[model samples]
Target chain A: MTDRRGTDERLAAWLDGAMNPADAAAFEAEMAGNPALAEQAAAWRANDRQIADALAPLATEPIDPEWLAQMGLAESTAVAPAMPPAANDNPAWWQKRWVPVGGALAAGLALVLLVVGRPPEDPQDGGLSLALDSTPALQQAQLDDGRMIEPVLTARAADGRWCREYRIGDVAGLACREPQGWKVEAEVEAAPATKPDEIQLAGGTDNTGIAAANARLGTADPLGAADEAALIASKWGDR
Target chain B: MADPGPDSQAMREEIIAVLPRLRRFCRGLTGHAENGDDLMQSTVERALGRAELFEAGTRVDAWMFRIARNLHIDAIRSVGRRGTQVDIDEIAETRGEDGRETVENRSDLAAAQRALQALPEEQRSAFLLVVVEGLSYREAAEVLEVPVGTIMSRLARARARIDAVVGRSQGTGND
Candidate 1:
């Protein structure tokens, strides 16, 4: 408790092993005599350990060989083309398209989707599909299951189908209006935001899956608020 | 196919060796698995693209770390977003039914991650590089392009903030 600022710096230096032997020894001796200081030092040490343990799982995730091949560190594996031939032809088409961009997020999203299965064909019975059918972009709505859904962007596909990009909880997805119901074309789990309120979509460039899906569909520019409202009112009717 | 040459081969090997640590560092920086991998990919691409700039005998890890840090900064700037944000409620709901101990451990991990994400970029990077990555303060300073003393002060401040947030969370008895 002598020179609190100096002591804090010394503590951090000692914790990081940045201090020279003599300085570290002196600090250690000070901590030994001062119970409060020792407790503070121990807490900080534990904090570091907690942080390390929290991040350790990320390091242990199996490395994707595509990464090595992308860097030319490994012999080039025959990477799937950026554009898949047909979306419905291969159930795993999204996986191949997203592998080059980075697979961890896509893989996680795929696992969740696999477990949940497709959104219920009957939109009335499905919260996500129901929200997509009606909710306009940039507004948040609560699903029946209690997850928050925010429609991000609205556009039309080349085939005269209406598509909407929306975020439901941590997942961002694209669902196109079809004769049957809103069909989820693609989804990717979004990166967790530091401030949930300030979470911005950044024009959807950060998510390759959504972007690629949009590209393949030849989606026009996202509709403005007024246009989007109109589309919602019309139940995504043909313009 | 042209031989990539000996220097290129050596540089490739060096990068391969550092990939795990670099991936961890990127994950810590980006606060998301996929974003971290994307950044890792971009870092490797940048390093290999600028292979000639790498000094022959210098630490490849440090050099690549600097690249990764700068790229992260640029990304943050481009997106006009500062730090990462985690949904506390989302994390809480995702807890499993394995056991009490498992739930507690996951809760602690989430708290730690949220605390880390709450820090300002400078403080967060310094703490990760020095404490989590086990880099010397000097090496961290080099990677951050700041003086050693700056690293020290940032680390101290970062540690205090983490302690305050985490300590308060634990005291609340709300997981």
Candidate 2:
């Protein structure tokens, strides 16, 4: 250790396999001469292994699902639009896949409405129907009774259920879609000025449902409107 | 207002798949399970909010890693903690190693974690990026926005301290 200048550096470089051949040879010679240095280097290697072994289990730990879902939404948004196909090239195969999926989904939605009862109106109005316009896809969900309902926010629960915060003419309630039908989970007075549905799909503080969903579903984002509609339609028709 | 185009579904699935690695990296840095998770959540939220900034055809792992590191830094600063980002003293106090037993009777791993927690935030970031995450020195340097030499220096110091701590714990530090 005394003979070799930069002994720790030599040992660390050797342990990490960053040493050049000449330096590595010199390091080995120094180690062979000083058994103590050799032992210390071995100890360092063991330490590295220990650190890795201890932390490796962390890889198996579940990431917060809400965060995981949020990541999915974010990454998708990050991707740039596809360049137009080359003059000689045909459209992408995936582009074709969505067409049938879209049509089938819309058809499914209509079919599901036949057996499904209409969503109960706002409790505040004693059953007065809300003047709800069909917004974009992700925020708006169709009920069984030929009525279009918009949830303030929608999310997937950890139990694999789809949950939504719905407002019917100033009355807000939380319901989750089940195999049977929309099961009302909880209900509360509508919070003013907060459209949990339209808060950019990722998140915000105003949406406690988003927070609750984060806890329940791990923050996974709802599918885009078209995708969700198609899925609902398919599931409804299947039932 | 971008419709989830053709690639969106695939991209979403890909991000979902990478969650474990992201969690691991976060845990490695914060050295605290809860804080690390909070950091992971914040990073993903930030990334999703700024998804349009991610360059297509680039390594998403690197991008996310960078995001996590930056968010951690921001979190530290927001708390008005100057100098070291993580509280070394706090880590030492709560160093029960997540209240779990050692990995396969290897107590050295626990010792290594304590040592890791003791390191300065910057050095720990550099060391973990290289050793745990398996990033190259040059690549880690880029992620930390520091010179390669700085990364090398930080890593060397970190390894030496960890070795000393692990050795001392095992009663074989001084041969």
Candidate 3:
């Protein structure tokens, strides 16, 4: 949608931050002249600030561990803005079908809660830091939100597709940046990243994507070093 | 979900760092310090329990938020505390790092609390998740278990209501 159309639908998405970079930019540009839209954005900001500030008090309370531990089954209740059930309607169907077909899968699924409580890493530092380059190099990063990203060797298999592994979400995944776009070859079954480094950013919004793409290139140390920040700044770090 | 690693050590380190933000989000939902900690603890426990459920191709915060939302709803329901609410001023008074002595007029803080508490739960959740907690609409919807469109509408409506409340509060004996 061309953001200039001035529809409430697009505006709502923009306010909620569902807009892609291009759309968001266009929407912001229009906000310069659109009084109604500007007012709407202000009110939204105000509302958010007030609520956040107000809710600040009750955030530190501790739940009775004994109570939480004794909790067996969750209470069945309904609330507003309801959506589809996350679980299948027929639990028996799964019991009869996929359960029998994949024994190991069934075992793995059953052990999920107990086996996977621990995180892949502790997220107490800064964030998921990364270095992307036009050349291949070993890069490590902590994300702004505290998720970590690190990379290593890449090689082409018999089929001639370059394959490498990186952490996505909370698990490690084998991915190939093919002509079609990056695709996960295999997924790592592991705990979630408390501070996730993953984002499905539109074309150019990510500070890391440029570096990731650069690393995709066959170069010496594709992710420039700390001084390289100045170098990247000289080229594309205008922001 | 796909973070680059064998960085279990690294990931654990970062999780420790981000706990404060998670605590903040938890605080927003529970409305008091004690409940917020309980909420955070539940959030952490759930995150650990559902670790494998964390997709390798999604945002980490969004995922934690999903766990947090479920836990919050679960706590509210399990305790059978439907629609039994409390005063926002009391929350601030109880939870404020700096007590009432720090405030110019305590009513401003009180007014802010009342305005937020007044919003419908859906709108309140949407506004906090999007504006304060910084989740995108799709992420917030995922947390709230609703469509992105629903999130947007609730947020918009929440904003309108807050503006009205704040405007009214500004005019009254309070500021």
Candidate 4:
């Protein structure tokens, strides 16, 4: 094979877009005349696509605490309030990276405390308790009698067995994957995030932060503290 | 640049936008699902931490990729005397030409990935930054702290070497 006039690497370089418009134009002309170089470029791009496809399949997956801990982004003592961002803000690719990955990663933490057991005798430590999986990247989760209770998400209501969401605020919502997908077994308004076990829906205060009741749970209204134990038995199917 | 806060935010945005592409680059570099995510995580962490270091309106993706390349290099060097070997079956396990699980003429893909890993760091870096990452010659030179001309020649040699290796796999490359 006759060696091309320019280096093989130069063509590779051109593909990366390192050249000036003038140089790029020149390179294009060279490519126009050299079918071999064109073919090589095509193959390189295909390889790139294949490699990329193999990577980052979990963009939509919640940013787990495990990943954050690996990066050293330890949670800060002072949780900064969400003030308005800069005026000339242009949305960045990296920041938006979170959206396609799963726009609802941090689903609103809507919580409701249920005592399905005889109501806790002591009003103080006495109800279904909820807490976020302190694990980094854990959108939010709860602890129920030492069991990890998470919101369930699923393609079908019966499948709603395991997905969970957390409301960071009225507008912000986040969800996390449950091994069993998500379920809306029994209708329960998630309690306030701060008070996991003893949450009672505040009367008429904006319910924006409330976790919307899933239609499949089939309960007309929210569940009472009396029904917790039996609700956990159902299963949800994944799409 | 005392926190070109606007620029910082902009850089972050730009980097996030190219995440899929960055992910693609990481996959090519790592050749495995877990390794790719780890590499990407490392690169993204570095980019976020060093976002201030990036010049206003600079090539954010290129900057992030440089970090990825360095991490991969450091990993290879750390393994010392032993390099990461990609399974030829992985290429087939991945996608195929006819969309089948068959290796589909990819005896060369694994060989290519291994050959890429085996190159002298400089040559490999130059080659991948250009070929796999799609960086321009000058841009790659900038990222590697080398001259443009050096990048061009290195790339030339890299391709020739890869061609020889792949050709051997295909039993067609003129050695």
Candidate 5:
């Protein structure tokens, strides 16, 4: 007996016109002899049409106006319109162009000074300096919601982002701090009486909520006492 | 790191031109309009934030699609980490608009959407890119960053699943 499932794939390909002409002709001849294959092929075609019909309506759905504004295309005009001259008529367009250049130069100079003359108290001085300035060693970060969670581990990811694993009660989570704040990347609730290592290996399975979390947590270099202290002082550098 | 160059402007326009299609793709991906729109909004924010990374003169649609796919994966991973997959079948069945009650009997569209949502994420994305987006298998593979054979395999599986669904529904007089 032919594998109906295997034939289903070929029929799907034939329906998609993805099959080569020679193979298509052979399949057609075979289907002419096999009523079941033909019926299956017909069903698959009907299904494809129905899928197309059903999904075509989605193309007409209205987009949110806010999204348009966010893309800077609310005006629906050419992307870069010519900038009008500044209200002061003293500067010609050519001279007006120099203003942005001067501003950029001043900005670049300021950046250079800031980098070269960083204050000794600057939080980002060095890893050691940051450690020195950090709050006394504590493994907790107070979330904006005023809930406290223990930071189980802190490490610099390969991407150079500092990430942390935190535990709130029995649930553990991973988050990497961005310039804005702590962005929770993943979380898993531990199974009762499960060891941390076991949960780490088991991952984020629905029953245990452990396996997927483990996979996402992956391997990270653990921050030492001083680095963790620095991170805590930096508040994940959100400051 | 948004670039204010003319190329950036042009890319923004290109993205806007594709917004309807992008929204449709999101809706198809997420199984609910609200969730899809939220995902679309997030996609727009990330695209804008990383505009400088966009290569000039490249297909912005493909780039945006890649970004959207990555974000969707991240979101689902986050949800998985939370200990449950989104029950897309239920979400697709009960999803409604504008305070209207969800249809008592699921419509053909809902059924099709549920079927699409039922596929694994990899398969769903493959089907959408090839069938809905009208991309060639190679192009879809490029967008997905997978081998062409992988794209074909994924599309085959996706089609088989949808075909089985529609075929069953038809056999039962539901379609």
Candidate 6:
């Protein structure tokens, strides 16, 4: 039974060309004597071909100019009128150019506000930093000021800083743990819930500002609740 | 403005050359063209933003694939909570770009995608990296951050699952 399973595994490795020349030769010789094994190998090969053929269009399709522009490699001939200036000077230039394209005017305004509203301050002063540091998604904690705060998502930004999106009352914002402190990246006023019962839904309000903030940070999808809890437990660095 | 220098320019060119395959790999992961493109865009942005971290003498395609895969896994986890659904009809519509695509070809493509989506994400990713993207098993293992043996096992199971799915579908059609 063990030998059969080993041979079965070898079939895959051999088919994938992962086997050395001698092992491949040995497998071929074995297959020549075993018609069933040969047939199964053939079937798998045919299936691979079908999958490759079906997915070929994805490789062949015209590359989107917006994608190229995002990488700062926009073709000279491509009609990318909205392509942001290839400015390496400002790190947040893409946020300014691309975030508003989602048509979230309020979120755009909030991003602008974040830039000029205040200098960097330690969030710990507001008693909000502890919650941002420790709370997982969908869980609420009371701030020292007695206001409720809920962490919506946690992600690592491209700059390798850990960031979290949270809601305090009707205001939603993103803050990254910088060397100095938790710096608020963007903030927008969330829509009020009509029914008190409706407030508990996860990310109930589709605040485009937070979404744009996530995109600007180039975060992978928000970490799952379990992962958020793990990160929080580790004090946000071990993972 | 100062010239960005030779290394930065070379990296940019390499990334541009790998875009199509990266986009294809992203599409395979997301199972939707638009979502795939969105993920691809994000991967490119992240890669470019951190180009200095990209080590010299490493395969650019492999590095980019790793970035794309990590982002996809993150997106998948978040989507699990969001309860978002990919529209199957959109798959058919998007593939209709070539006016000459026959009903048979479209169904084949849809069937292929369905078979792919049926597997777990890990298995699907392995199959794509090795079979579709043509990465060597060693390269795929590196991209996935797993042992080469794990890649072999995943590929074996993926092949079996896909064969079962495609075989059953064909059998049902004949019946």
Q: Judged by DockQ, which candidate is best?
A: 6
Error of 4 at B35 (Å): 5.7
Q: What is the per-residue lDDT of model 6 for residues B23-64, given as tens digits with 9 covering 90 to 100?
A: 888877766666677878889898988888898998998999
Which lDDT values do the candidates have, in the order given? 0.69, 0.56, 0.49, 0.46, 0.58, 0.70
For model 1, the superposed segments whose C-alpha errors exceed 4 Å read A76-239, B1-3, B81-109
Candidate 2 chain A: 10-residue stretch with minimal lDDT = A106-115
Give each model a TM-score. 0.54, 0.50, 0.45, 0.42, 0.53, 0.54
lDDT by residue (B1-175, candidate 1, tens digit) is: 3567878877876776677778888866765556677788999999988988898877888898899989987776644443344232112213312112212235555565567666777888898888887889989999899999999999989988889877887798855
Runs of candidate 4 with Cα error greater than 4 angstroms are A1-7, A20-63, A74-239, B1-115, B118-120, B127-139, B159-175
Candidate 1 local lDDT, residue B152: 94
After superposing candidate 5, which stretches have Cα over 4 Å from the reference?
Answer: A1-6, A76-239, B1-3, B84-106, B170-175
Clashes of each: 4, 11, 59, 61, 8, 0
Candidate 2 lDDT tens digits, B75-124: 66654545444454244333522332322233544555567776777878
For A1-239, candidate 2 gives per-residue lDDT tens digits of 54343666667667766777998898899889999998888777777777777777666443443443444553432223223222222211111112222122211211001111235434322111221222333254332221235555555767777666555422345556654446555443322322224222221122232233345445366567666566556653345
Candidate 1: tens digits of C-alpha lDDT, residues A113-161: 2111145367543356667877778887655323467888898999888
**For model 4 chain B, where is the 10-residue window of minimal lDDT?**
B95-104
Candidate 3: stretches off by over 4 Å: A1-11, A20-37, A49-239, B1-11, B81-112
lDDT, residue B147, candidate 1: 97
TM-score computed on alpha carbons, candidate 6? 0.54
- TM-score-better candidate, 4 vs 6: 6
Q: In candidate 6, how many Å is residue B23 off? A: 0.9
- Pick out the ten consecutive residues of candidate 6 chain B with the lowest summed lDDT: B96-105
lDDT per residue for candidate 4 within A1-239, as digits (tens), equals 23563646567557556666998898889888989878887765554454323332323233344544454432321124343322222111111222222223133323232211122122222111223212222233322111123322222123333323332322222232244222112222322233223222232222222223333232233223223222332221223
lDDT of model number 5: 0.58
When candidate 1 is compared with the true two-chain complex, its DockQ is 0.22
